[model samples]
Target chain A: MIHLYQNNGYNIVLDVNSGSVHVVDKAAYDVIGALEEQNEFHTPDTLKSPETAAYLKERLGQEYAEEDLTDILEAAAELAGQGRLFTRDVYGDFIDEVKQRKTVVKALCLHIAHDCNLACKYCFAEEGEYHGRRALMSYEVGKKALDFLIANSGKRRNLEVDFFGGEPLMNWQVVKDLVAYGREQEKLHGKHFRFTLTTNGVLLNDEVQEFVNKEMDNVVLSLDGRKEVNDRMRPFRSGKGSYELIVPKFQKLAESRNQQKYYIRGTFTRNNLDFSNDVLHFAELGFKQISIEPVVGEDTDPYAIRREDLPRIFEEYDKLAKIMVDREKSGRGFTFFHFMIDLEGGPCVAKRLSGCGSGTEYLAVTPWGDLYPCHQFVGQEEFLMGNVEEGLTRPDIGDAFRGCSVYSKEGCKKCFARFYCSGGCMANSYKFHHSINDTYEVSCEMERKRVECAIMIKAALADA
Target chain B: MKHIKTLNTQTLNNTVKKGGCGECQTSCQSACKTSCTVGNQTCENRK
Candidate 1:
């Protein structure tokens, strides 16, 4: 499938299946669009047909010289002939291979502290209880979690453990213990452990930063933009804003570590629809890597992103793309996570087809040692796949997620951003439709725009 | 009127101008709470 669009003064064409990208002039873009209008799939005979050539000239006769039109047609046809444009879905053959592969666990999002110190309004973890009692994973459970990862990882050498929580600092000691244990076990198991931590920064201090710099591979610090915006949704239990308390900590951590090694991730709701400024706001505070996720909640929730917000949100993304280009050119650029896409040498087809490998190669472990498909599905009892002790008692649940793919999702099947987004978020799908194969419209729309913006930024930077 | 530049696997333009290690542990699983958008951003790359 080919997607054509104009963004930031560049007319871009993406051959989705083959991962080939082309920047074409208006006339060439129109020629390709015409061919798509005639036939969705391009076969060799259909490309070289005299009837097709006559049809192209007849359809676009006034727009260009017949010779130029003919030349473009030949070029497009040759590109298609070489499997670079209008390519058929050759990925269908690999679907079975993706399903049949003996996938091993490579990463675990370990919910170290199921309890949280602060109350965030838009938090999906329900302030870290996850619909259960507030708790922290014991060192025993954390050790077994790492051991389980090393055991189930098969031949994979790089194993990941993310210390995620309502606040990992709430259970700081166990986190340190697990890291130490993970390090000790790595050489023996022939595995390398990459530990990460995600926190709200209320508990961040000099000691934590020192330990993090030494042991953590990446750290995710959450803050929801400006003072008022952040305080409104994410307040302390005593009803205080966290912005003033955490900003300095976040800044110090980013400055201490390689700036690119950490992400200052925030969430934008209807309250902060102009999130581009929020992104710029982060840049102002000296963050070089930022991710502001959309706050998706029930329609009844005040902050839930509605369909009407899309146009404004889309414009914001367009505006941000230009700003990013300017910033990069000025040598003060930051990496916006969503706008990051690799056009070349992207993830393997197996990864593109099956995303993140959740419920399969990547799993989430709860504080009490229960397993789920991912952190988003932490409290979801239905997703329980067993614990580190028994190891995958409900393998069927993981198998179900393994079956999901861009081809499997109704919305993602025809999406040009399918390979990039990898079927949206499974937890989101389950929430909207009660099935993983199904996905929601809002996320799909957001993802497609990000892909376009990412491509535009790439093109604009190339031009600049 | 003809302005087209075609790039395949080998000639694909990178979105980020700077090139370094793209692999990061758990980055994929973090993005969507399941996948990383451009790959991992682990600090080991810094090392």
Candidate 2:
């Protein structure tokens, strides 16, 4: 038997026997309440003061507060505890149990190649002299990494083998082998296999496109809007324009049967910051979903676009979303929003509050098998988590990361958007500031502004 | 007789020790979900 309680706006259920507590939803509470009511002698007929009135008020005002449902569910928890449905141990162990249930990354990044056919100017990987010393990962490392992921199968529910690099398919053989190996492992473990690749579409051919269609779960392609802008930003290693080469490949891949699995990614630069028209032009390309990210530069660099330009960007982005949404509604196949705000209401697997969990939930393994917090810190020593061979069994790495607060950054604690921002990306903070320890004020400011846009979008579509 | 049963249980307990969730520590993706900043300028251009 389980009893429920509402504490601190959380719905908590207490186990009658071991006193172990579980958090339950509204339906679960209602079922228990009905059961208790059926056994007339087990529960009192007279209604409680807090639960009854609170439920009435919350149910009546459900339209006013989006979170009112949570409040009502918690009331059931309060009732369960008052009825002595559980012992003290149930409540005490609940937090620890929840921590135990958290998801862990079972696999690591396998960088198939570090050499790109087309070089983008704003790419962090190709910035400065580091571009010349690119390397490709061997099949040997891919096998070892896959084996390691398969062996450590205790904690993770879904095993994701992501191919990232200068461009993953630059060496397609290794990717093929890894995918085959991952499938075998999936058969053995009985857990689902998820694969994703981020690439510059230059090297993607018919065979590669077919393999991606059949195997990969998500594919993110790089496109920098119109021809002139793309040519200016992304060129060949010989400094020739790559827009012609990339656009044809994009067309080929889009025409492929696997086009539905792809999403468009564009990087905004200072040159293109004023070109909201360019964004609309990119949307006109017929890709169902797209993501636009601003370029990062030195504080003094003229290339860096400030967060103030978001309103215009938001307008362009919203237009694109509307087009895509309309297309889907009109039975022109399916298109998804890159920012799935509705799906991310609760705990989302794709994102964390501050940023993607670079240090913990995800690890970026370089071509040399050196482990870093993420791909963004490939050359940087500060973000190294552990080596692929030695594994994540060390104490110091976890301790250092734990001490680095996602929420408790000095400035973040006071920021209004702390819950949503989570101190931004720690790796970005370290690389630009030359310190692992710093406040994420700029990212938070950008997020608050974005939220303002979201509010406007909600209001505009409230009646629709 | 009760003393004998307690001693028997103690001897059996020596073969196995109590353990927590798993040898792998901290399965929580709470840290990751919390870490994402919405407007990643790098990805912002992709739109």
TM-score to native of every candidate shown:
0.94, 0.66
**Predicted chain A of model 1: TM-score relative to the true chain A?**
0.98
> Per-residue CA lDDT of candidate 1, range A1-464, in tens?
89999998889998887778888888899988998888989766787899888889899988989888888888888888777788877676767767767778889999999889899998888988989999989999999999899999887788888999878999999999889999999989888888889999999999999999999888888998888889999999899999999999999999999795788989999999999999999999999989898986988999999999999999999999999999999999999999987665455555566666788888899988999988888888889999999999998987898888877777877889887777777778888888888878888898889989988888878777
C-alpha lDDT values of all predictions: 0.82, 0.52
What are the C-alpha RMSDs, in order, of all predicted structures? 3.7, 13.3
Clashing pairs in 1: B28-B35, B28-B36
How close is chain A of candidate 2 to the true chain A, as a TM-score? 0.70
Model 2, A1-464: lDDT tens digits are 44444432334443333222334445444544453444322322222344543544454443434344334434444543444332222222232332334435554666668888876777777732233367888877777777666655565556666787778877889889888878887788776667877777878788888898889876777777888888888888788887777767776676574456566667667778645455556556665555555666656666565566656665655554455444445555333223333211222211223234455556667776767666666677655666668776544553444345443457654443433344566666775676555654555554554433333233223323
Residue runs of model 1 more than 4 Å from their true location after superposition: B11-28, B31-47
**Candidate 2: where is the Cα deviation over 4 Å?**
A1-103, A127-132, A255-259, A307-338, A343-345, A348-355, A393-395, A403-406, A414-416, A437-440, B1-47
